[model samples]
Target: MDLNTAADAHALTPLLNCLLREVAEPAAEHGEGTHRLRGSGRLLRVRGGRRPARPELRRADGWHPLSHSELVELTSGELRRYTGVSNDELPVDMADSRATVAALLAARAQAAPPRDPYLLSEQSLVMGHPHHPAPKARGGAPAASWLPYAPEAYARFPLVFLALREDQVAEEGGPSAATAIDSLADALDGPRPPAGYRLLPAHPWQLELVGARRAVREAFADGRLLRLGGSRLPAWPTASIRTLYVPDPAADLFVKFSLDVRITNDVRRLWRHDLLTLRRTDAAAEEGFAALRRTGSDAAWLADRGYRTAGFAFEELAVLVRDGLHAHVLPGATPLLAAALAEGEPGSPLARTADPAGWWRRYLRQVVPPVLELFARHGVVLEAHLQNTLVAFDASGMPVQALFRDAEGVKLLRDLDRPAAWQRLVYCLVVNHLMEIGGALAERHPDVSPFVWPAVREEFLRYDAARGLPETAELLAASSLPAKANLLLRWTRADGAAARYLPLPNPLRD
Candidate 1:
């Protein structure tokens, strides 16, 4: 796990130099031999043993070497297919009389030229439906349909689409805006997944929405759905009112609509100022929004610098354009399953045990700092909860990226009557994010008793001292900012030792 050191240099240099070359960063330095790697792109740190002979430790291009378990799980098949070799050809190392798989992948001294040398046009395949015919001219001016009421469960804005079975004519009742949504709930008698077409299974969160009939109908009638002619209907199935379309076997682009209603309601209120801050297309304008999360600010910064909004919003709807930040969506992408980690489900990557703390440690090391940076720049706070945050992995199974969504939950501090910026930050950053995982960790390891909610709060304060101590003092002095957040930091670090805990459930054992 100790990746920083000269001993790892031999294995690191090959990949590191190649990564540097790829990025064209001639001035990149290897800090103190083992200091943490730093960069802005997806290719983070690339270090692995060269040809399994001379071990190399390097950091370049966000692509880090996959862990042994990850490598075995992700690349074994690809290695077999690419090398045209059976399991026997793969190397096995006998360490302490235990057989271990160790393949000597040739170290490409020069970072392999972008793997496939095909034109961008030749390389990309048309995603979703390859062919979508125009709607046949048969009906009168399309009748308008509007959802009579909105559903309470629409907190997470969902990008929806309208679909009709192949047999359903353009002028049929199902095609009308009103009934188009109803079609999703109804089965397609004639429509079937085409040949070679695979159905991507919907996750539990997605399934929950699909199962609700009223929610789907409201979403459809509200014009939140993407319209597709006959052939396009198969790819974007919103015909049924009872089911939310899980755009699987579909493209990565997800659209969620945020109408004026979401902002107007007193409950789960979204302020207009927040809307104004979010609406500002200029990344330079981020300095004013005190509630924006560090990651959100970075996004605005990137967008300001001519970086395409791999994601953006049009009115209440937000679209994720499957580019840039969203380039890599992994299996354990959403932290939803991780939310249930205390309950046994080894399949989930977030299930941290005493032995495999690497994933969470790396996750925290990479994510938290950037998050704080974003918060410092934009007062906007991103609710990077289990669901809103997504983990993107590289070619290997290791997590190398993070995707954050749910713009509605993203809060603006000053917009509130009395902005408790720090309180909000602590509630979200510590109470929400760390406490959930910490509770799970404490459950697994009872010996680590000091790692309670208060202890975690102190640890956060310690981290703040080390990273943001100057800013912390300045914020305390700034009367404009909320004092609760500042006080929480002080009380937790100075007087939190005697803090009594209310009876709490055992997060893990239960």
Candidate 2:
């Protein structure tokens, strides 16, 4: 497919997915790939597997094909009719997202894909978040402004070193892990600051965005902050644009920065609220994974160990140091992003896998048990969605381990009761993560597609039978699952953290 066609299709999948999921009537029989719009009384048709594309709308004249732009307009109009709200901002974001895809494709053609499967998987989400409208939107910034730092374009850039006055540096976490931050600074080949200052690495793009601000400039002028140039080597931007995975063993850590620009649902920033609660959340998740490991499962959690930032521009200048995969993943296993797997990235190393059944079973074994255990035993409801989850495969191309990250997204039992926590876990684990990956697996091995959901049911059944968990019993009896209403949330211009959920069909059988 050409750029426009490819971009349009890439952009339309989520929009159509939203429309079909939220706005369209469920009782309307979807013949093949066609469905009737709920409120507008319009007929729509599509024919594609996984990421649906080539959308057509029916009118008195005949079938009218909708491009990405038309899809955006239709989605906007449908959402307006459905929600009775006019969201002018989302359409522009949708357009920007398609344009961003074109820019990424163009840049990727000239660039070399990473040799590491993990890096490639990290950058493979060209059509990210199949349920999110405008998932690839880059805050409506100019393509030139964001393209060089985009993960999809294989972006790698050195971190801009900002030396904050020792007295002005704000941070929290245990000493052992926090010392790694200082070690990373001492290790990097950047200009040394005067004796009293500490090194604070900043995402170059974030620096560009927040540099012109009055507070940041004032801090630089006074002596609270000093610009000491960038690091000698570049770091690979991960799926979450704010996070970068440093390749070197000395500084082998995932660093997350506060980005001012909006991506997907929120301004991709390490907010102060999450930062304040980081240690507690990280500790809880760490305990959960540790207990799982004691059970002989190699499941791990990449704890967000510590963070450092200037007190003046805390939100904009903050950075967190997360545990790297090198320590967590099993020997001879390659950690691949779950989102990329679900995306059906063609170049994935899994091409050699012939036994889809065994692979799928092993995958479920590694992923499902730990997540359920975390919820049931530790009361830590992990945000184990595709992006936050990684499946490490062995030399034989079978899943050997599962590793999860992002302490900032974790919800503690103190905040949520058992029922609420269980509901969220079911959605994140079953609907958002497994269903997509399972769909990709089914698409690849249609011969075993019938076995997919049945296996999932079996896993839950086995889990319940082994643990005698009431939550699993309730889930098995439940008729529907909660899916995050991304399209509707965007249409209503709601906060990203203020996620709204709607009922979705459950495939589980008693």
Candidate 3:
């Protein structure tokens, strides 16, 4: 397909999905693939499946097909009317999302995908967040600004190195009590800094955005900071555009840098509040995964060890160090992003399995157990959604293990009430994660699809029986699942950190 056509198809599914789920009601009288906007009481039609497509509006004369831009207009109009609110920015964001996909398609045509299956999986999400209104929007910036660093484009580049004077450094897990961030200068193999200076790696895109600030410029103008060129080797941008995977054999690690631009919900900057609580959150997650290890589960947690940033531009220049896959992944097994699997990535173990039932059983056993176990045992609520997870496949394409990351999204039991935590867990694990994966699996193997939900129920039943947890019983008894209202949230222009949920039919009960 041509880039525009492809981009339209890519962008339309998620927007249509949001509109159908959040803004529209079933127009059962009109027929299947038809829905009426609850806000406007107008009918719309879409060919539905795992990816809804080819949306049309029921006009006075007949059905009129809607183009991508027209669909964005309809969504903007519906949201504006529904909420009794006006949003000028969201419409631009929605349009920018489609434009961004077109740019990514153009770039991917010329870019070579990485040789590694893991890297390929990470870069495969051209259409991310199935329910997000504008998943691909890069803070509404022009495509040229973000295209070079896009994971979708298979982009990789050297880290821009800078020397921070020792006195000007503000670090948490480094210095007196050191983590990887302390000695990262030497490990990165960047040019040596002066006797009183420490090396800091930065995202080039971020530097460009923040370089003009008086504080940043003053540091460079004086002697507090010095530029030391880029790193010798390039790092691959992962599915999360800001976090990168450094492929160095000797000093392999994932480095997350602050990007001022917003991607999905929040600006990708590593805010100071999250930075302050990083160690605490990482420790809790580590403990939860360690408990899984004691029970003979090989699931791993990629630790977010430490971070480094200059005091002048704290959030702007902050860089976080995360654990590499070397120590965690099983031998002879390749780890693939869970999100890519949900997208029905071709030639993957999830796609290649002859016995879909068996593969799904293995996948559920590896994925479902840890999330429930951690919440029940450790009071640790992991954001166990598809993007935050990785599943490793052994030879013959059998799933052997699952590993999870993102300490910044972790929530401790002490902070929130049990009910709220449980709700978040269900939303992330059941609705967002399992539902998408099951749909993908079903799409590929329709015959055995009947057993997928049964398998999930059986696994949860087994866990509930073993642990004697009440939440499992409540979940099974509940008629609906909490689906995050991404469309509604975007329409309201609410804080991304705060999520609102709408009820979705609980597939577990099916």
Report lDDT (CA) for all predictions: 0.30, 0.86, 0.89
Badly placed stretches (over 4 Å) of model 2 are 26-31, 347-351
Model 2, residue 221: what's the lDDT? 91
Tens-digit per-residue lDDT, 1-510, candidate 2: 788788887888988888888888533374677888876988898878567788889889988998989888888888888888898899999999899988898899899988888999999999999998889998888899998899999989888887899999899986855686776675467578779998888898999999999999999999889988877778999999999998788878999999988899998888999999999999999988878878887899998998988888889999999988888888899999999988888845444479888888888998998888887788899999999999998887899888999999999988987778877888899999988988888888888798888899889888878876777777877888898999888888788888788988787755
The alpha-carbon deviation from the true structure for residue 255 of candidate 1, after best TM-score superposition, in angstroms, is: 1.5
Off by over 4 Å in 3: 174-179, 182-190
User: Cα RMSDs of all predictions?
Assistant: 22.6, 1.4, 1.5
| Candidate 3 C-alpha lDDT tens digits along 312-374 | 889988988898999999999999999999987899897889989999999999999998888
TM-score of each: 0.37, 0.97, 0.98
Write out the backbone clash pairs for model 2. none
**Best-matching candidate per lDDT:** 3
Q: Deviation in angstroms for 130 in model 1?
A: 43
